[model samples]
Target: MKKIGYLILIICFLSCESETIETTTVNEELTAQQKTVTTNKNEAVVIRFIAGLSEAEKSVLRTHYGVTAYEKCSCGDENLESWNLEAIHEGATIEERVSSMEEEPEMEGADFNFDIQIASQVPTDVISGPIHYQNVLPKIRSQKASVTVGVLDTGIDPTYFRFQQPFLHNTVLDEETCGNDFFGWNFIENNNMPIDDNGHGTIVSYMIYEQLVNTATDFQILPAKAFDTDGKSTLFRIGCGLSYLIKKEVNIINMSFGWTTTSSAIIGSYIKEAEHNILMVTSAGNTGENNDEIAHFPSSYPARNILAVTAVDGEIPPTLVPILSNFGPISVDVAVHGIGLPFYTTAETAPTSVTGSSYASAKAAGFAASKYQEGTAMAVFYHKILLDKIQSSTLLQIKYASYLDL
Candidate 1:
């Protein structure tokens, strides 16, 4: 047990209009260098409704729309008249069903939805080598961290030696708060035991842990697990997870996963609401595409509190190497050393080599926690402290570096 901490989170609140964030593509269409998991389910559609429903109305849904089953994400005030959810129908794909709901006059009047945010997985495997844990990073500030980072992803392995005891923060516990025995909220199972079934969460956790440990920063990790063994966080899950983190009042959030969508009002509402409260650090994704063209939330979300982090490789100075991380001079705020980095996993005996913007964002989270100025958090505060913003269009785009450089 190297540290100790505490937790709460509630989700986005906004607008009377129902929504359909079209997360249609998996967005992993990359070269042979990049690989990711793309998931497409044809049976259901996620919907966000803005009206309070009665049993009579629910019955009508069952009788008319064949809504055999539905799960609602109660991420906001129970009194609030909004329901983010998904339902299973008899036939047709998610897209078709969403279209059907919107066109149906009765459902439209009953608070129908738009924008389909499909799910996606990040690029896990990368070029590899023997894991190395013996490097002296240049920036080691005397200042210890005085914040909590809510990690939204697959849960972490508390069984791991590093994750046990004080590593996990304890929060107010009860029927409404985090259970005394758990690390954070598990949206996947709607419980407090957010143990990592998939290794993605552990890898991301390990990165932030290592950075803080090596830097001698005092901090706690709040595990807001929304993804499970399937390693996917949909719109509803993300909302539930964000709801948890916000309630916890974490200083920083590390989101190493994303989905590409144009109309992301569902997710954007949260981003806009949390703009002045919490600072969000997210991966620009490993798709190697320009984020300006393909908006990846909540990174691509136009918010002052959200930062889109990209990945770059090689030692600083003369050896910089570009990898497959997504980037846009405007969309992506900065870059970090995220290529073929060494990380640990609970499923494996020792550390392994992996690449993706996920690790980059994790590193950036630690950096933000180290540099976070207590007071009102402004995204531009971190953005302005860049060591040097690259200006040469013809030169190598290696201008990005860890905030420690400054």
Candidate 2:
């Protein structure tokens, strides 16, 4: 099969809430054009090809089209070779491009590339009140390594004291093909150390750790750094991250980041493959737009065990509409505290304040982890209970069948 290039269109804007002051940071670098994959005029945007290509077919691809085959990365996921590829060829259109190759004597009816897509940009911040998830923990059945939660973001701050709690096991994954990482793989530097340079991942991981780790000692947190120090990543990296977690048999995955457009087919396939095995919790984005109108990936990806969470402030008749959060009575699954909440950043030991849907999603994932059971994690059942346990005062009464609607 011909591999197609997948790009991730990421847009990030962050805000923090503190008792004394508030801060906002807008990242203008992430956009559609900026995020698109670039190839020379003579190169073709291909990801991976079907295995067992005859010698003749290989010659046609290399000599005739100047296409070069190479491994996607050292992440060690077999799907990486099947889902991501790059080559050099000229084609007027995607269909036409394939037709020309098929015209060859041995190439007739041969499949080549799979469609690719850009990734969504997901965010964080917090507001405090009566603790969420407190009541739900006792109801969950806990066991050692009963559930593993994957945190895919910039990276985690392993040195954080809060994360050092004996009950909390922030287990580091071994990227054997590459080496051993005490924390997680840094796809940016292709290194074992996935320490957070940007503060986004730290906040995302911290929020979840604080909420669930101590409550559920048997629950494990696996950090998979998909984004770089600048808070940017491609759909390929995101896919690899998911694949790694899936191999680890993680029960829940927290994607505190998002993209506004449809997700790439390759990543979608991975999500589909893990549909029954994992539950994905993604942020609704910080755009404040309606996701029902303009879909967000992983969140909008119609699949099983995927929950899209929006932000809500801690107020009487709680404000489900965060000034910087995206919502879709139809697209989002729930709303939680995402206003001015105190948390830690990569650069600081003391707690700082932040606000966004990313934080809300983390909170939701943490809650899900608390309730998750390896063999009996019924998506619908847990979803119902989650909605039931959510602070009634903090939830919005929407028309859609959403957690907030409860």
Candidate 3:
């Protein structure tokens, strides 16, 4: 009887091991195939699934479908047995499958919304015209002439025509490998060179340079790479990136990335650093949710040295705020053009249009840099100039050109 029991246990162990090995092989194969199949390169797919599965059940599902990563809910609960369906179905049409799945009653309230859209069209005349500089540049140009504004977001496309003569100092790349000290680096590629694989950083860079700097008169940019292709980053990596920028003593730092909340210690450190006369500019996020209810870190931190900005659309008049712009009486300090903003693409020849609070933050940073002056007094001076501009504008006026028509 004992020998019979031992034999049954041995059989179960071997069966489990076989399943594990099979699952590993399947995952490896799927990952290799996913790399080759591309769809909606601009959008990232995150899968969500129902929870409350036993260990055996999860293993069975993973082995059966070869699942590798589990997507988490906004509440931080892990949804086991989920997969990036887009990746899993690579090369094959899964729209029918997705449609059928959506029809199921179990998924009625469990469905995830992937509604983020990147703007594709911008006013060519506005982008090509020199009116931006003629109207806005002279007021703040002399103040920012010598200030170093660091952009901590996606890496910049150095070859872009608009930035052909940008005052860039890269903090991402390691000096030993790139041979140049100021070129940006990418931690994702494990290299010193930080060229943008995604166009988000490039677009943000141009908005700051072309609109703010070119208009302001004489301000330069310091490019700092932070987020990668997926538009995801952690507080630790952000801290490391900021440390590099601090060492450079940049006059202004623009950050377009943030989570609902971040470590208090990290936030405090940033404030302390800002007190040293470095102005920090950040986005108010794009969720369109109430920031007071769900405070975003870095931006939410109450620091006198930091300025939190929200987005506005350029299609509106200069005095009105953009409809999509996030606002809070306390959290957001000001608003700027955040939608359908023109910027250069990775192609290096012509410009592409994109939008987000990321662009708004860059605009604010560039505007501040353009008016930057040495000493704490100068820092306060530039901040006031920007704040005054925001208060003078109204929402309706911000989205229409008629306000500027006069």
Candidate 4:
């Protein structure tokens, strides 16, 4: 089958208490383009292929296209390549980039095509009803655990009011900045600290901290920037960031970003680290596709007992699942509130509402970390308390229907 390229389009969130965030659409077509430009003798230039290429084509691409990195499809088959330029030329001719070969790659395994599905809406009237917090927070707060939760995403704003305390550490910068102090390290720039070009990371950090504050629980929040403001980062940078966390042996790791394919080396290293008993929670992705068809990677990688969470909109009655959330047996471990949730902003000035599986993954991370202090494996803790609640609730519903039939 033809390899598919996935793109994510995000809509901004309004005020923290806002009921719903608007949705946006992504382009459906995939095409390749090339441009020729004048080059200065001292300036270096790079050519990137907008689509996948073959190994022989890559060799030809290197000779003609001058790109630093070629974009490769993560579907196990290598089909695309990009080129970087070392020098610019005014006389350089831009050629149309395309694959001469037309044969489609073979699809192995199951012919599963997973699409994003919207679940029932959550009831807003019972917003004050008994939530998981009512049952778990009290026990956790009383213990005053020193558990640390790591957020791996866009860099956070340290000065955000919700994370102003000393408990918040920016692992990317190897420095501790308060909620009122915002500093970040940009892996793209090879900086010492993180900076929030995109507000998403800061928002996610705020959500986790807010949960801790609301629960009166004492836990540390470690901010790790895996993506930059442009919503992009190199696979090497991500691998390095995770390596840092593994070295620290933190209690929980929250990852909200993923691509179509994963690096086996990087994933294997993480699995080895997980063997040390650290818990990982990831976003199932917002592709709005079934897990079998286009599930996000890293979250979809074959790992034992990882928590892959889907997003749900809380503004709608009955807490319906977010339409963009990718789901399948292999993709989603559970669902959590992602939209219309209150969280802190990059300015740390006030709280705001934001939507995305990023927040859902954060919530899961915070919840799991809180329970870890109770001496439970992160996966086991969530499975026993949280997953059990969901499974049992479903079972109860089925039993009630059978009883009525009898």
Candidate 5:
């Protein structure tokens, strides 16, 4: 078993929303395949329990170790078998906590920012044009069950005109709007309203919403506002957001954010728990680094259900993505057109653009939702579908998998 991957990790495991308008055509044509852990002023330490912690261990952690401000990550009704915790460590350093923790029942895993924001600010290109819509209609119509996609990013702009369509009304709430139910839970503000204060979730959701809207009308997006206004998040918040999604039992989940760490075992465990139930899509990350060489959490977590996406631009599958995009035959599964695409959200009067693997992952989630069947090993089955569709090309940029151009 892997030990704690410490904050400056060589670790992994780990782990958005939008609106509608003219229906941004994300994948018009074929394409070639493709944050930081920070400390808070409060100095809280993050831990993941492989098995729920026993009362005795908790007592030990608090009494002897000077751990305080304990908080357990909770899902709505779904009790997660494996759980994550946040507590204020009184130790001088994380290394001190670990060294002194020698006698504790084998620390499963711990870290500060297991999963941080996937930097989406690198501008690859600015798209401006007449705004052409390509995916005129959804792909699958008469499916057995309607698909619900979990958007794990900043809260979505629920008021977006496209998201307000009658079809998505029930999905927006996910549950009954008792007093003031919103799209999904907000881990940041501790409220039901996960409305997007930052534009990242809005844009990410726009790509997904446009794709799903074009493909099928029965789809719904369950937005869990994981990131705050600064596009940053902590492990506890991310775990909580994921827990909410898992409890909601969505068909597919789009994780547009991730951090780089070789020691992301804690986050990986949470995702590992969810892999059996939901199909997950994540960004391959920016920084123009090779994911094959470096470690990018969730994307590089080596899970079957998680599909890591990289960005591309335009109609034909590009030989290479923008300089900011990360690619790897091993870590990344597919590539999509998430860059240079003009998108309009409720926050924007005109089409706007930004660069990140977040958009590409959203497109993949939307596409997967369009193709998702009711009863199946969704993660494995959909994963195979994407991998099989991979165009057999050179292993230059897209080393193993092919670029997805639909």
Candidate 6:
């Protein structure tokens, strides 16, 4: 009997081991495929190297990898630096160059910024109850303050009626004079026009625009077009946009996009670092998985400045949680209802209804921006004040997996 019991234990252990190995192999395979799809086969790729490059090191990179341009990035530490570079070499693949560079002592931490796919969710318009913003304006007018909110997504259509409305005039910032940027828009494609060929950015930007307008708040929208017409961008471009916003001292940033795989460590590092100073608001993704169980970058990152938002539906005793919106008690910070909400499109197009945590994130970001206070201490306190207002006990009851109770 003892021998038989020992045999059963061994069999159970072997079976569990086999299952674990199989699961790991499948996960690795899927991850590899995702990485491959994200790779752009274009002649050029973006690379970030350990910073503080000597003239000799820069010359070596220029000669060896055909580096065309480079910029220094401070990944949290001003003293510790990182360099973003655009390079082209006919013979070698990006992976090959990365591996070769890693073997060199000086270039140990060199890495490529992989492409980031947009979190696309087309919203359809629906007649909904009032959100109190239009009414809330006059009451809070005395407390209103000027704030800058950076929309890091597809470009906004400033010609739209919401932007053109006389009451909302001069809310959009003047074109940035910085390198490769334009007034009210900046594109990663190096094009002078930052128009939205895809409607996602326009829709996302409107959520913030409408909120500020309705509340009669003094605010400016800095539209940074990191994604292209296909709704695609890379960590390199996104990082550049973030750097631009940081330099401008924007009080809040809205990133209504994300990816599942931990593909770009450098970009992840940037997100983590940005939270040190600016309020970073991001979507919790649409995967429907618990982010705490399966992490999401920028959202699940352990940062006090990050407000990870998930989606809820219907207000008057809100109950529905979008089937696709990711949620977690620990990972997600708040929830907002944007599903089936009328989204503003281009001047030529009619408004449409939209879904996904993308809109939720935008709404939260706009709310946070509306509640912005000037001082560093006020910034923290006011953010909490806004959160308290948002996480009402009644509303908290309706949110899925929400930890915030007010």
Best by lDDT, which number? 5
What lDDT score is found at residue 188 in candidate 6?
A: 58
Instruction: Report how far off residue 100 is in candidate 6 (Å).
Output: 8.0
TM-score of each: 0.67, 0.68, 0.56, 0.55, 0.73, 0.67
Q: Pick the candidate with the highest TM-score.
A: 5
**Residue 399 error, candidate 1, Å:** 9.5
Candidate with the larger TM-score of 4 and 6? 6
Candidate 5 lDDT tens digits, 193-239: 56666656766777777777787646777778878766778767877
TM-score of 1: 0.67
lDDT head-to-head 5 vs 6, winner: 5
Model 5 residue 349 distance off true place after TM-score fit, in angstroms: 5.0
Candidate 3 per-residue lDDT, tens place, 1-406, comes to 4345334534543454423100000010111100101112222222223345565754564444333444332111233112444444434433444444444332211122121222212222211211111121112122224567777765655554456554554222222222323344454343444455445566667777865646655556655565665454443345545655665667778887665532234335545746657888877676654556667656777776677776665654443243445566667776676665544333333443555666777777777766666775745664464544633436422211111110
lDDT tens readout by residue for model 2, 1-406: 0011000100100111121211223232323211212211122332333345665655455445434553354453542532212332453444455456445443312233322222233232222122122221222122236666788877665544455543222222222323343334666567654555555776677777777765653666667777764566665567667777776666888987766554455567667877876888888776666778777776888876778887777665456663466777677777767766665433334444566777778887877777666577456645543655434534443223334321
lDDT of 6 at 401: 33
- Error of model 1, residue 15, in angstroms: 46
Q: Give model 6 RMSD, 1 decimal.
A: 19.7
The lDDT values for all models are: 0.57, 0.55, 0.49, 0.46, 0.60, 0.57
Assess candidate 4 and give its TM-score to the true structure.
0.55
lDDT of 3: 0.49
lDDT of 1 by residue, 1-406 (tens): 1122121121110221232111111112222333332333334344444347665765575455556566654443221122323454466544555566556543322222322221223333332222111110111112223777889888765444454325556453223444333347777777655666655676687778777777676777878877766565555677667767877777888988776643445456666767887888988777776768766666778777887777766445312234366777567777776767654433334554666778878888877776666784475556643533443332233224332221
User: Please, what are the lDDT tens digits per residue for candidate 6 over residues 178-254?
Assistant: 43232333545554334555556766777887777777878766667778765688666776666656656678888
